[model samples]
Target: MTALGLVHPGHGAEDDYPRIEQLLGSDIRVDLVHTDLGEEPRRAEALRAAGLAERLTAGVEELRLAGAEAVVWASAGGSFSHGWEGAQQQVRDLARAAGMPASSTSFGFVHAVREVGARRVAVGTAYPPRVAELFADFLRAGGVEVVAVRDGGDPPADGVAGWGEERVLALARDADRPEAEAVLLPDTALHTVSCLPELEKELGKPVLTAAQVTVWEALRLVDRRVHAPRLGTLFTREPVVQV
Candidate 1:
C-alpha cells in the first residue's frame, strides 16, 4: 500500500482523508496527523503561524510510524496565507523535516489545475475576501490565471466545516466565469468530498476542492496515481510528469 501522510491544522474536515482513502481503494492509505492552529482567528497572520515548519515537524514521527511515503500540508488557508515564496519554503522545510517529498494544498491546487490542462481558474472559497485574494495571488505566482475570486462571505453557525452540499455548490457558482477552465475551493475546513461529482456537474467544469487536491498532491509527491473518477476531473486524469 502507498501511504500518504497529511499534516492537518486543528479540527475540521480532516475526516476527508479517510473518506478519500476509501474511495482510492485498499491499495492506498491516508494517514492524518493533526496539528495545532494556534490561538488566533482564521486570518492570514494566524494561518501563517499555524503553518510554521515546527508545527508540521511535530507531526512527522507519527506519519513516519504510519509508513507514510509522502506528506502534504493539508490546509489551503494555512499555506496560501504565506504567499507564494513563503509557501514554497514552508513545504521545503516540511520535506526536510519529514525526510520525504512534501507539498501543501496551495501547491496542490496549482499542480492539479495544470495536470488537468487548465490555465485560467476561479477561486470559490469560504475564506474572508482578504484570504481569498491571497489564494488568487498564489495561483498567479504559480503561472495560473485567476479569472475571478468569489468569497462565500461568512461561514455557517457551525463554521465552514459544517457547510453542506448546497453551500459548496453556491460558492463554486459564485466564483465561476465563462472563461474560467476550472473552479477552486480553497478552504480545507469545508467538507467537499461527498459533493465533488455534484460540484463538477453543476459548474459544468472542473471543481478542485481542498481535500481532493491535498490527497492528489500527496500522491503526486510519491509519483503514484490512482483511478478514482468520482473524485472529479483531477482524479480522472493521470499525474503530469515534470520532464
Candidate 2:
C-alpha cells in the first residue's frame, strides 16, 4: 500500500483524497494530519511568518507513526508565507524530522507545472491580493512565469472551504491567460479535484489545483505510478527521471 501524509490547516477541503482514490481506482492509502489555523479572520502573513517548524514537525511525526511514506504540508499560504527559501527549508526540516521525503502544496504547484511542461502560467487563489502575490513570487522563484493571477479576496475560511464547483471553475476560467499554458489554483481550501476535468476542457489547457498536485508529488516521492484520465495533464503526463 502507498501511504501519503497530509498536514491540513483545518477540516476544510480535507476530503480531497477520496476523489483522487476514486479516480485512481483504490489501492492507495491517505493519512491526513490536521492543524488548526487558529481562529477565523486569520492573517496569512502572520501564519506564514510564525515559527511553524515545531508544529509542522509534530504533525509529520504523527504521520510517520501512522506509517506514512511521504508527507505533504497541504496549505499554500502557510508555506508561501516564508518566501521561497524559507518554504524549501521548512519541507527539508520536516523530512529530516519524519525520516521521509516531504513536500508542500505550494511546491507541488511548481512540480505539477513542470511535469506538464508549462512555462507561462496563470494563478487563481481564494486569498487576499497580498497573499496571492506571495504565491506568484514562489512560483517565479522556481522559474515558472506567472502570467496572470486572480484573487477571491478574504472570504471566511469556511466560506472558501464550501466554495461551489461553479464558482471555482469560473474563477479558474477568468484567471486563464492566453500566454499561459496552464492555470494553477493554489489553495487546498478550495474543492478543485471535482472540477479539474471540466475546467481543463473549458479552458483548453491544463488546470491543476493544490490538492491534486499534492497527491501527485506524494506519489512521485514514494516511487509509485498513478494515472487517472479525469485529473488532467498532471496525471496523463509521464514522470521525468533526473539522473
TM per prediction: 0.95, 0.93
Q: Using alpha carbons, what is the TM-score of model 1?
A: 0.95
Best by lDDT: 1
Q: lDDT by residue for model 1 over 136-236, one digit each (tens)?
A: 88899999999899875553456788878898888888889999999999888888999999999998999999999999999889988788988999998
Return the lDDT, model 2, position 211.
Answer: 85
* Model 2 regions lying over 4 Å from their true place: 40-42, 49-51, 156-158, 240-243
Clashing pairs in 2: none
Estimate candidate 1's alpha-carbon lDDT, on a 0 to 1 scale.
0.88
Q: On a 0 to 100 scale, what is the lDDT of residue 231 in model 2?
A: 81
Once model 2 is optimally superposed onto the true structure by TM-score, how far is the C-alpha of residue 32 displaced, in angstroms?
0.2
Residue-pair clashes per prediction, in order, are 0, 0
Flag clash pairs in model 1. none
Candidates in order: C-alpha RMSD to true structure: 1.7, 2.1
Give each model's whole-structure lDDT: 0.88, 0.82
